[model samples]
Target: MARFTLLGTATIPGKGTELRLLQRNDEFSIKIAGSTGELMNSRLHGSEDALATLACERISELPSPRVLIGGLGMGFTLAAALKSLGSDAQVTVAELVPEVESWNRGPLGGAAGYPLEDPRARVHIGDVVELIRQSPAAFDAILLDVDNGPEGLTRKENDWLYTSAGIHAAQAALTPDGVLAYWSAGQDPAFTERLKRAGLSVEPVTVRAHRPGKGARHVIWLAW
Candidate 1:
């Protein structure tokens, strides 16, 4: 069986440790040592498209909207957001890993399609949670693909993002009628309830990929 090789490792501020970049033949992935979640993917088929679709749908209403995306990953969500929004739209991407950003600029550039070069895009190398906390009704749309799901795959600190307090903070950071979209690897009924508890109008959208035009199945929580 084929396996991934260690590409490199780097420490990120606020994230508290070194993160590893891995490659398997043509594919790339990022994981924190001793952590369970896979961060970025060069395969183009993992978490990117789903996040892109979610952002696109939310930004359809406004021209030149300001969007905030949590987690840069391989830049798939950022690329998709740029493609979907108008030229005037601005996207702020918050990524906790500095090496992931470097990888995207280096070997992962082609796979991500160089989203950072876009004039409307800005990259923040820090915790997305801090950004959300500081931002108050600032973004037209907030798209979160930070962890594997509500259960969290990497750092345990990520649990706050799925909690009632975190949901409230996210809601406070959104403009009135703005959309909050979250991508999960699988469904979580309890989290859906938590969204409702946060006073959001919640909708669960299930999508599949790897089959014809669509392959793997993904669940997206659309809340406002």
Candidate 2:
């Protein structure tokens, strides 16, 4: 077995949480410094890819569609989104931690074919919520893969993204036909109901972490 090597570390601003990057041979993993679980892995990104593909498919026909992606984990979602959208579309990715972006620009990038190199991609080193609040009705789709889910396992501040107010902000940020998608480690029925209360039609999808028919199950909520 190849022993894991520590690559880099970054502290989550405001939250005081440290994020560590490690590599075992060609595979990379990101985890909270003190946690035993991985936040993201270069190899198990099927669900992340699905998050972008599924959301972009709905808005594919729109002319010059605008898409917002929260969390640039391994660049899988961004790469998947870009592939699904037309060449005229623009994708803006908001990553709370700057180092994560740097990692993508470095060796960590090859896992998703270096999505940041895509000409249509624009990186934002700030909170996704702020972007959602400011861009009212501007995006054709918003995909969020930040944290573990609506439960805020990595950062307490992430809890807001799952709140009624946050949901409404996301609702207001979308075009009339826009979609909002969220990635989770597991299903959250209450979060689905919350989307309903926010007046959005929601669909919860179960996906595999690895390629189809393998690995752990993850959930993605698509609301429009």
Candidate 3:
């Protein structure tokens, strides 16, 4: 085993929270120095990839399907979306912290197969809420993995995305049969009801974080 090496840090806008990049024996991880500890570990992203795979499969029928990925943590979700979608599909990834995209281009690229370099993938270095706000039925699927769960951690404003208004915005941004998927460290029954109230058919799925029933079980809500 090797000790974790601190690589770089990025500050979350408005909230002022910091995200630290760490490396250890070829493994990389992103830790949020917020009240809630470690954010994501590169070695474990099975559920993250599932977030995209589960949603994309339902919407793959569309030609040139457009996807909006809320967060770009370690690029696992983006990489999986690119791998699963068709050649003409477009995946838009919005990452609030620019350094997260840089880390994906630098040390963490290989972990997710350098998805940022893919031609179909578009990277936006801004708040995903803005993208959702601007879009109106512009996407076939929206994958959200910004925080540990529906609740906000890294940024206070993220709470809006999970609220009724945010849910409405996400629904408005989606096509008629579009899918909305969320990756959470755990489950939230209230959130499920909210999705239903937003006029979406909700399907709550529980997936093992490390596959093969290895790590903790994570919940992904696939709403349409």
Candidate 4:
């Protein structure tokens, strides 16, 4: 593998943590400034796509479905959701870091086919919790891929999303038959029970990080 070249860095608004963008050949990676692990890589997004695909499939028949995505990451989830949705569908992406959105608009855009450019896609630069709180039975599907997983790696605040309160908020934000999907690096039986306690039916699906039957195994929890 070739050495990675630093592209840019941005500090997470309230958290004050820095995120670095690096590129090696045609591939791109985003990592926390002091962390050794990559937060997102353009080459691996199978689970990210699954997060949206699994959620979208449930609401595909709705005449004008509305979807909410918690994190943009490399835009893989957003791209996959747009691909699965009909023209009348609208997808709102809530991205905490503005630079991540910018990266996707720039060179990182091509990695996911520039889903943000789609007319049906909307960008919200703020905490996804705020969006869920304000919305009441508004979305047909809500996909969360923020901060790695339920345990969280980048932000401590992300832990709230996995808590019972957060689960209820997500539940209230969904339509009667809406779906909520979460992306995780690994599975958590506790989180599965948490969703059930919040009155949702949970289905945990394992997916590959790179391609089918290849790469790391990740998890996607579909709740309705």
lDDT of each: 0.82, 0.95, 0.90, 0.93
Q: Please rank every candidate by lDDT, starting with the best.
A: 2, 4, 3, 1
Clashing pairs in 3: none
Off by over 4 Å in 2: none
Supply candidate 3's per-residue lDDT for 129.
96
Weakest lDDT window of 10 consecutive positions for candidate 1 = 207-216
lDDT of 4 at 196: 91
How close is every model to the real structure, measured as TM-score?
0.88, 0.98, 0.97, 0.98
Ranking by TM-score: 2, 4, 3, 1
Residues 1-224, candidate 3: write the lDDT tens digits: 68989899998887788889989987887887654457888878889989999999998989889999999999999999998999999999999989888889997898888989999999999999999999999999999998878888777788888999999999999998899999898989999999998888999999988885788899999999
- Candidate 4 — which residues are off by over 4 angstroms? none
lDDT of 1 by residue, 1-224 (tens): 68988878887664567788888877888777887776555664544666666756776768679999998877888988888888888999998877778888887766778989899999988889999999999998899988877988666788899999999999899888788999888899999999998888999888664323555677889898
What C-alpha lDDT, on a 0 to 100 scale, does residue 222 get in candidate 3?
97
* Candidate with better lDDT, 1 vs 3: 3
> Between prediction 1 and prediction 2, which has the larger TM-score?
2
Best by lDDT: 2
TM-score of 1: 0.88
Error of 4 at 52 (Å): 0.8
lDDT, residue 218, model 4: 99
**True-vs-predicted CA distance for residue 93, candidate 3, Å:** 0.3
